[model samples]
Target: MKVVVQVKLTPSPEVATALEATLRSCNDAANWLSLRAQDREEDRDRTRKALQSFAYAELKARGLSAQPALHVIRKVADAYSTRKANLKAGNYGRKDSKRYQRIADNPVRFRADAAQSYDDRCLSWQYDAGTVSIWTTAGRIRGVPFVGLPGAVKTLAEYRRGETDLVHRDGIWCLIATCEVPAADLNTEPDGFLGVDLGIANIATTSDEGEPFAGEKLNKYRRRQIRIRAELQARGTRSAKRKLKKRACREARHATHINHVISKRIVAAAERTGRGIGLEDLTGIRERVRFAKPQRVALHSWAFAQLAAFVKYKAARAGVPFVQVDPAYTSQMCSWCGHTEKANRPTQELFACRSCGVVAHADHNAARNIAVRAEHVWAAVNQPHAADTSGAPAASAAPQGSRS
Candidate 1:
């Protein structure tokens, strides 16, 4: 598995200036290349090498060396690849829609100080000395100190692999290094599956009747951020825009930290009890769920996919089996009984089954249902093709209730 570790770089004024110039040059060149490639970007395999051949000479003349110039070309190529993928995925709306046309026609643009990738040739890390020797527009800068926790620094020294990105965000410079770590063996015969239902209010609730990982504090923080962002956007001033960027970055960092914490705890719990981690297959949930204007911001503010990613990776590292089960009717289905009726969930928080007369927290009940489904799905997928799964855990989602 691959993970990224970011360390803050404390560079001298001269080195910082050179680093800034390098990024600007790299991104500026990228924009120039993007305009040329957007037309032929659909044929990535054909265009990537062609772009490198044509753009490299011009980039060298524009103050970049051989390696940085090539990196710039690849970066622009990757950007358009991403753009095409997003369009194909209908992220910007239908092909006939104005939003789709606008994004499709326009060339990908990058900010002046956008992060730039550096390979081993351009960057070298010295964890013992907490310093790096990095190539810059003003030539090579050596002994640039990086700040990070002792344990994290140790991990980086041991497992750091591939390229590092030089990012300049809100007056701070950092190197984000990718680390290749080994994943633990999959726990095939897990005791059982621990179902986790993810939501906005109660970030995650487990099937084992554990306390929900509530995001009360984060919700409050996000609310304040939203209000502040609105006020800043209304100001329409340069300083407000700068502050807006800073606030957004701050909120993202906090959210990422929270996701890491929640994923670590959940993975640890599942591993300790020799249980697999089961999650709802919430792919495309944002596009599926409808919400009022007042709730849209709150509902969409949280990153469900990011949280799921954290859990999956952490679980993999801990030798815990992680799988996503179908999420249809989980909310309205009863765990005690297979009764599936809309009335089973009268409110968002409470679930009272009319058939079994069982009352429980809505998310907790849904999590339990997910656990049952996960067991069946895991068995069906893991066993041999001809193996019979007739005895696997199963439930009928048909809306059968006492009222019928």
Candidate 2:
């Protein structure tokens, strides 16, 4: 498994100036290569090598360093190749003028290879001792301090160091290190499954146990941000625009933090029970569900994808298997009975099965159904003959009320 750990870099005034200069030079080199590659319209590998050789002397004279220059060339070439491939596959239209312009204005990305640039020297725990150093156009900058190294990152530092990216954001510099960790041994098939239902009202509802993680606070926060953004956008002043940008960054960070917390709790619940985690496959849910304008906006703004991703990665790390089941009928269908009808869910929160007289919270019912379906899927895959008898998968079969 791979994870990225971002550490803030605190450099002196002289080193900061050198870093900016190096980044500018690298970006300029990348833009030049991008234009040349686009105009040539030839094979990518051939073009990349030719461009590298063509620009090597000038880049070296500019004090950009050899490996970093090559990194820029490769980055631009890969981007151009991807765009061309997308166009050929009909995924992108011919009227992609905006995309073309954006490519032309692409900024410099300064990447440091562990081998070439850092010489395989990883950040040490003694970062506070000011012994860490980084190479730059002006020379090596030693005694750089890094802040906020997460526990996971500190552990990863014990292993091999990989490539890192130097990113400049909002007047701050951060080093994003890509670290590889040993994959968890999730070979043990779970005895059962814990279904998780994700929604705007309740961030997550697990089938097994515990109170649902409510999203009321998060919902209020998002609504406030939405109103604030709209007000700033309406003003259209320079200061308002700046505030809008800052607001976006702030909201994104807060939302990511919330997702991490919620996902961790959900995964921990499953891990405690020695069960695999099941989630609704809500892909393209927006297009599937119809709602009023206000509700549609809220649904669109919901970070279901981000929440699911967090749960997935965290579950993997904890050796808890995670599976996504089809969400169809999970909400309307009664978990206790095979009965399926919209009347089963008369209200948003209340779920009472007319057929079996089963009553439960709507979200909890859906979560249970999801868990059952996931277990059925696991059974079908492991025992194909079990499904062959019915000529249909167990999960796809209409729910029959629990046989007494």
Candidate 3:
């Protein structure tokens, strides 16, 4: 199992200025490369190499002497490639335009000082406990202590696997680590199964077999963000822009902290239940329909994917099962009668099956339906192959319909 531990970096003001300057240089180099590439005279790899070399020279001139991280150049190139591809595909949506704008404003990133050894190119030095330490702060943090990284490693195996990514935020940097654990098969399993419903309003509603966990703190933080953003939007000055950026960082940091807490809670619940988790296969919810303005923003902010990812790996570590069930009608179907219809979801927070007269809280009803689906899947998986008449079970045989 792999777990990540992040520690804040405390850099002197001078160091911060140097780091910011290097980032600006990187962005400038990337912009130049993009403009030069328009001529089609240089290959993509050549352009990327040239940009990296330019970034290196820029830092050296500033007395930093840091080597440019290839990842930085690759990311800029990828952004440019994406823009070209989208233009060719004619996906000229506002969202795509906003993505282009984001890429254009990012700063240049370097691996380490150019004077450092090849192995130490990306690592920064930290003064702590009356000693100097080295750490890789390329992706994470402006400055952070290096000694904290090794303590978070779950195993030597993970270190050998080399799946750590460093990230920077709030003028500090830290390591993000990934570890692989064995997965459970919920379809052909012996243990019980858990069904979970994710949503913007409630965050997550699980089968009665399991308890529900909501991101209330996150919601509170989001509300604060709204007020801050509104206040910023009302201002018109350079100071206002600075304030807006600061507000944005505050919102992001708060959201990230909440996400980590939520992840830990869900994982702990799964471990307590000793059952494989069954979640909705919500791979394309956003693409399928349009929502109201506030609703759309809420849906996008829920972070369902991050929740799934956290549960998956945590379940693996705990030797619990984790699987995804078809989500198409899970919420609209009646848990009692299996009758699926939009009318069953009679209100925002209520589910009333028109046919069966089954009524319940909307989220609770959906959670129950999900649990039933998981149960059926469990039964099918446990049944003997001799009992199976078809290569795969028929969809009609599976429970169908949802209300909300």
lDDT for residue 343 in candidate 3, whole number 0-100: 86
Which pairs in model 1 have colliding backbones?
A: none
Give the per-residue lDDT digits (tens) of candidate 2, residues 1-404: 77667777788788879777767766766666665665664655435677787777776776666677767666776666676676566554444677654543443232332112233442333543633577677776777776764684465466436666777777787777667766688936797889998876777888854578855777788789889988999999999999999988887788788888889888888888889988998899887888888777677766889999888888888999888888888888877655788998898877888776767788888888888877777667766666332212233434333322
Candidates in descending TM-score order: 1, 2, 3
Choose 1 or 2, whichever is better by TM-score: 1
- TM-score of candidate 3 relative to the true fold: 0.68
Clashing pairs in 2: 338-399
* Preferred candidate (lDDT higher): 1 or 3: 1
Off by over 4 Å in 1: 36-46, 87-101, 234-238, 384-404
lDDT of 3 by residue, 1-404 (tens): 55444444455565555545555555555455455444454345445666566554543453333444454455556666676576556565454587554543443233332121212335433333412233223333333334454544334233323333444555564444343434444333525556678887777777653435654655676767777777888887789888888877776666566656666666566667666677777888899868999888778755678777777766666666666777767678776776779988877777888876766767766776665566556556656442432222233432333433
How would you order the candidates by lDDT, starting with the best? Answer: 1, 2, 3
Q: Pairing residues by index, what is the TM-score of model 1? A: 0.89
**By the TM-score metric, which is better: model 2 or model 3?**
2
Root-mean-square deviation per candidate = 3.9, 4.6, 6.8
On the 0 to 100 scale, the lDDT of residue 182 in model 3 is 41
TM-scores of the models, in the order given:
0.89, 0.85, 0.68
